[model samples]
Target: MQLTNKAGTPVQWQDYLKSGHRIFIGSNAAVPNALIDNLIENSAQLHDIETVHILTFSDNVWAKPEHKDLFKVNTLFIGGKNVREAVAEGRADYTPCFISEIPTLFKQNILPLDAALVMVSPPDEYGYCSLGVSVDVVASAVKSAKVVIAQVNPHMPCTNGHSFIHVNQIHAWLTAEQRLPEIPDQQIDPVSERIGQYAAMLVENGATIQIGIGKIPSAVLKYLMNHKDLGVHSEMISDGIIDLMKSGVINNRRKTFHKGKTVTTFCIGTQRLYDFVDKNQHVEFYPSEHVNSPVNIAKNDNMVSINSAIEVDLTGQVVSDSIGHQFYSGIGGQVDFVRGAWLSKGGKPVIVLPSTTKDGCISRIVPHITEGGGVVTSRGHVGYVVTEFGIANLIGKSIRERALELIRIAHPKFRDDLLQQVRKHYWVPTYQDNTPTSVPELGAVELKKFTLGGERFILRPLSPADERRLQEFFYSHTKETLMMRYNHHLTQMTRENSCQLVSVDQHKDLALCFTQRDHLGEIIQAVGRYYFIEASNSAEVAFVIRETQRSKGMATTLLLQMIKIAKKRKLSSLIACVRRDNAAMLKVFENAGFVRGYSEDFDEISLCLTLEETITNAKEIE
Candidate 1:
């Protein structure tokens, strides 16, 4: 074979190709279109030629049925729309492998490459040509191939980091000045935007995020505009990051690894995105082996891996690669980043998806993964699963707890069906009946966060999923505290009792809890509840605070919110029965405008508050 020092024609380079040669095409936006066209133009010159690549934005003519006899195509990840039908029809093959391990396949000769066709930027002053937008596994393929042909494109961005190769490394070269392919920005739908909002809440300031491309991920970036010192350590970066970088939100100033640099393996977006990374010192493109390695990714503290999934079961099993028996997409870097984030300090591994499919007829949160569906992320690996409804933290949860948490975030229409299925599987107790109730009033109540005595606490409507936590809260109180709240000595709280406490119908009555989150789960600090009395158009109210959390204004906050909710419900009056010796409880009710009421028992004091008259007085407590 003759190696050419100067630019050569495709026809001249085609002379060196042989039968049964495995050719690797550059992945993502850096595909060599001219060389791909050359192969299709001279298909008759080669038989049994194998082509391998990751994702390509070009027209996959080589994978079509017409070229089946001349060429065989294998894709590392099935993301391109044009190649799906061919893969499903067996005209093309899908190879499942983690993006981080693809380089090992080439270097170990497990998938030996006879030749590699790549596109690169023009050589710099030192004769080094950057791999440009896609370094990924292409760098390894070029190093392992027996012959390397390059399409030198002036349009390609000369990215930083380990994205360059010496010009002498190519066996032959040709110039192609065409613009790189672009993935048009997908329109963000309402469902995707809502999911993005919930996913963004899990990301903290000074956190490193690994987000992919799509409407949901793009929406997430939109919500992150106000976050401080965010960093990107992802397998791919798209147009979404450009705005965040410009806003100075993602300065990479606090990243534990590769501080002050945006690290990625590949890129696909509009021309503006390509131009943003061109010779940009802050953006560095590395090989997948280095960028997607779990160990390397965990080096960043507070790593939040936000990835999308096709479907998730009640058991927290995530299926992303396939739909039933059909292959939809590849495993990609989801598992790599999930585990990496899970291993990091203060990390959050989040899997986000819309509650239902695009049609809204089918629920993505199912009792079981579809038959023949592949589980890309197992139950043990799942952390936080977010949907439009809310976020479910699955880490350290039991099967029953996982089911309840997942059901809480599932589409409302499917919650009952999912509950029935979980019962059939015996994942939940037979007595468990905390399927979420849909009420218009429930939607109006937003999650509230408050700080008291220098500690942060969250106040929200008590959920049926909080049965276990409520029971734990019951045990956390001292005997004296329980007696004061219940007006009797209460020794034990059973699951049945705990379930009833959390399962109040919001339409008729109210139940709210003050909570603080720790590593184990959410801990209930205080609880306030009410039951309606239809005869007097009044409600019986109660309050309970943990022994250690009392006198910290938690009870006052819960009481104030309860009054607001009661007024919203149009209740005429509120009544409470407290032990005469419970001075603190009396003071809270008195401060909230409750007046003394007649009581038949001497050991207890009855208090009443007229909802319509106390509106002004309740504000004074705040």
Candidate 2:
């Protein structure tokens, strides 16, 4: 790698990044540690430096815990190590995104940068330094940065690869002999190996591939050596790909974008693979923005991206790095590849996971996500979901159908419970002719309960084992449902309970009640929602519920239950609201001794149940 100034003039040791310049560091393991060291070393002299890095590894030593006043690492995704401190200690912040669109953040100047720090191998006779192992959007960083510092390393493999900066392309150089951080060998489990086989089966000869790192990704690569011309335009590559390369599988000659070039951004593996990627012209490694960008990635048709997950709901909500509320990993490139592959002609972005956990106690698929679970790829963005059982093409499906499909593929022991959960959470009637309505296209992944001789079926709380069926449910219904759940708001949903169990023992002014779901096996479309039935002074009362599971009678039942419980916790009159067209709902309030009120707004009707009136009604009935 060589250095040059912005005006095409070479600088020996110029500080291109001055005050007020926004800087973009490579995301993940591709982050330039040398550049970060330089920034840390020079931080005392710099002010208001906005640093950007996506899903970076343990490099936060430079985003010093004590240096918050000087540097700000504004991130789009929250990786595991930095998440805890970021949410609580307020260090590195979280940005919600699918991996597919990160490059847009840079190209669109959503977060502008003043400079870019890139790491590369020494330029070859052709006068171009290879970006080495990683290619994800770093090219966008290099393209947008006001200044560029090329850090040339000798130990880095000069493999002919993707990342590139022609000798005339860069602005400055900080030559140093540095070691690439080592990532231990990724070991795959037998189940993951099966999933890898399934994922690899989807890849055809002459297909261009994009893959992230991890057991599932590496395992998929392990099974791909026998395939032919399996070109790669990926963000990162590990040792698994080396075997494929040596076997003459990843030739990249037929690739439409970087023809005859295996493109990538960063790589991690044993030195054997590292040596394979060094300054190799056949391999062109660049920045993530270029490699991961939907535009750049879309250039290669038949791009197949294989990613993994912590959990995938039946409705296609992918929770790859988290368990409900806790942050585990960042959304790296799941969405990027999913979307890129979706947009590419004949492309497929696949999320591969095992059918069950180690204990077989929990299914990885689910009808819905856990509480506080982040929906990374809203159903629309997902295409295929694979497990050892089979593949489910969830695109354009109803959540109901998606849930059904997910259930069929779930671990046999856990499928029924997951299906029960789907019914409860989705509020859907039993499937007819095996055509469920959980898919988003027919309707959004909603509670699909329609009248069955005046009785309605309702889905309750969803578990992880119901993902496929939920995905099919989205496909089963009309797109109207998707827009309602993900796009449009079908009803007003907000958690109204001040007396939540979470608020218990806070010793605050509110009376917090302990809500219990001792029965995780309870069947409903969702945990309909808890109502904080509140009774104010002068015999006034009201109730509120959360948004995910509205119109499912939790509020009405909770209100009636509250009236009894409050009679035990002691209260008088109870009041509630029922949208006029909500006939079944008005009956719930009326049946609970509430008197319907004539309001100017029929859409929002009021109901009142006086204790005196209720006692009189009980006496009359007696």
Candidate 3:
């Protein structure tokens, strides 16, 4: 068959073919396999022919040893399973570039393409063809390549937005029918489910979110099913988003930028997902230059970017693209969205991974990154790291604090060794506690959110990693409050002293704090704790509230929670010593059924609540 250009002149495929030509291929599921197979069939006519592309789901026959002499393969993103061995074996080349900047490489002739092989939807009535599900960098390749060969497929979804290419631009075309490649869904494991639960908690209602592919991302989407008005501005979307969109959870109505539209560069999922976006007006596809641009992403308020990592060092450096010197995957849009989310208003850049590898023999959290491993997300760019163990907020943390926070969320079996390593490195003081505490069940230690004075706050158990936060809380307290709470004019609370307060065994002695989050990080607004008195068959309780946060009934709330905990422990009684002048605290205790008693210290009065009697009275009242 003879193909013709817009000028109506018959075009021959051999006329554009040359021995040393560099060719660009469409990325992901949009690869034009028919054109590629034809090129391979004519390999005898070509030598030193370089082929460039990003990730592709099709069989990478060009990278095979038999075709190595004829075609030199170079990939922008190293994610194809069949091509990874070739790149690792040094037979194929991997170029590291951000998805957002890939277009510039083509536009400026940096990677200079002689021809582009692409698959597109059949031309519409206006003679314009849509780039379908993979418009990311293919749009630039089509415009910059000298010779454009297209495999027009009827199965390609004719998506909306900046995905159209006029048929006149094509030098030649051939009709083909093929199913787009699909990414099979993997089952969500327990570890991934836990990480997802924690990551989902960081997302708020009516917020924009960017998530990538994999078990952890799917788990996050699973837990977000109940969220309202969620928006998506991601580089790609998978089948995980279909249920959320159908349930009206991801309406994109509250998005600050590109409101009412789900923005993406490409997609790779099942036929169901393709059918969902085929003629869907709510879904819009744009070039990676615009979709992954940090400035464009930051335009949306409350942007939450959740990405996975291969390994993370204690100091917050993330290794994603490679494990040591071996290239695993290409530098995709992780940094782009992370920086974008960091710049957005009320944004959260979250990294979620399992605490250990699949075998559970190696910890993903390490004292340092594996030698030669590239740091894709620098320590400064990292905000939150989540594992099945827990979430660690590392923004604005010191090296010592970062170490402690990361160690706390690491696998328990490796915590002591990690602590020793950090101690040797002087990341933590020598006197820092080395005993690893048992991880609490999620149901028992889940964070409780409450609002006071029109501001939100969280109440949860104090962790050993909270030593610095506890110190900050001490410094935030007024001198009068210190005297009233501790009965001493304490001038300073050293790290050593703060460590003792935060590292107690919760089963024996309980410590809890109320924290309010701001631009700086979580700030402690109130602290309530009780020391178990075994001999007395009771517990000694105390409370302190930040001066600015006082008189808002925080003390009452703390006291009530403490009472509930005490009741659960089945203690005989609860005790406290309050200064006579502290009428507010005295009322809080009294309202909770604490009876005042004479005290030897003239300035202080003793208070006690007998649990047995209180429960009986409450039951009678009920």
Task: Tell me the whole-model lDDT of each prediction, alpha carbons only.
Answer: 0.86, 0.61, 0.86
What is the lDDT, from 0 to 100, of the residue 238 in candidate 3? 89
State each candidate's clash count.
Answer: 0, 138, 0
Candidate 1 per-residue lDDT, tens place, 455-513, comes to: 87767777778888999999988889878987778999999899888877767878888
Best by the TM-score measure: 1
Q: Taking the tens digit of each residue's C-alpha lDDT, what string does model 3 give over 1-622?
A: 3345566576665667688888998988899988778677755667888899988888888888888888888999997766898999999999999999999998999999999999999999999999999999999899899999898889999999899998888988877888999886789988888888888878888989999888899989998998899999999998999999989999999999999999998999889989999979999999999999999999999999999999999999999989888889978999999999999999999998899989999999999999889998999999999998777899889998899889878998998899888787888876687533642421422566677777777777787789988998999988889999989899999989998888877777778788976533888889998999999879998999999998877877777777777777788899999999999999989988899998999999999999866632221100
Model 3: lDDT equals 0.86
> Can you give the TM-score per candidate against the true fold?
0.93, 0.61, 0.91
lDDT of 2 by residue, 334-382 (tens): 7777778878876787888888887887788977788877877668877
Ranking by TM-score: 1, 3, 2
Candidate 2 vs candidate 3: the TM-score winner is 3
Clash pairs detected, candidate 3: none
